[model samples]
Target: MKRGVSAVFLDRDGTINVDYGYVYEKEKLQFIDGAVQGLKLLQAAGYKLIIVTNQSGIARGFFSIEQMEEFHKNMLDKLAEEGVVISRIYYCPHLNGCECRKPQLKLFYQAQKEFDLDFAKSYVIGDKLRDLALCEKEPVKGYLINAEKKIIAKDKNIIICNNLLSAAKDIVGFKNHESY
Candidate 1:
């Protein structure tokens, strides 16, 4: 089977770390259970791991962009220590209605151009429906974490999982099937 420019776009906050409002301090960052392992698995499976997050805290005056960068630097350093290297990190700092926010495909579009991604072969793993909804154009695959039940999108490409690791498995498995 053949895959396109496959990349795993991850949402931060609840999806990667425990959702604590405007988390800026490095000590405050906590990886959800199995997140590091899951990311390693995806990396081994040849998936480019990219982070697409919405951080309205910048607009809300909770944290500055500099603080966000510091947080991300700490995050990457920690992940690196655990043998996980994120290909890229993209964030939207605007408040609600921002074109780059979740439910909007702006960030995805940017990633597509920057990473040369094929939407059909890409997956967005997030904890919210809006993340899945944003990829409407190409009906990109999606994995929703911590969802009570499977998400029933008008398009059937989205899959819900218990956590980030499970979602990574689902994506890798789906690609494997396509290859076979």
Candidate 2:
């Protein structure tokens, strides 16, 4: 995906931080090691850092939308301390039958409009299959974080990374690689 000047679509729960299932509390936010550094690397490489997450916690009544926003604000504030700036974060709070949900490509399209993203140049990273689903419809690449080795398929365009740090390395490589 060397199409240039594209965004990096990320899944929040497991990709950026630990997913404690409907995790909302700010204190519950445990960032994956190297998550911030990876984001920073992407940001420095001129890639837009956008988060596309599914937060069914709000729809499930486990948390409120306001609470989720506040938590995200806290997350942004924390990341800012480390010189990381997330361009935007999009989340779908639907349990079912929503086009904005992952695997639907709705949010990615929306992001394209607002962020001027080139899908062919973009990247998606997540712990689940839906995170990489956008790649199926677009020409970009996807990275599946196999922290547990639960995903056991050899996807052609999808790279398997041990963590976000490894994914960041590849992203940087892709950006700097001349033959990309």
On lDDT, the candidate that comes out on top is 2
Model 1 pairs whose backbones collide: 1-179
Please provide, for model 1 over 6-60, each residue's C-alpha lDDT reduced to its tens digit, 9 standing for 90 to 100. 8888998888888878888888899999788789888888888999888889999
| Overall local distance difference test of candidate 1 | 0.83
Q: Model 1 — TM-score against the truth?
A: 0.89
| Segments of candidate 2 deviating more than 4 angstroms | 1-4, 174-180
TM-score of model 2 vs. true structure: 0.91
Model 2, 67-134: lDDT tens digits are 99989999999999988888989999999998998888898888898877888788999989888888
* Highest TM-score model number: 2
TM-score against native, each model? 0.89, 0.91
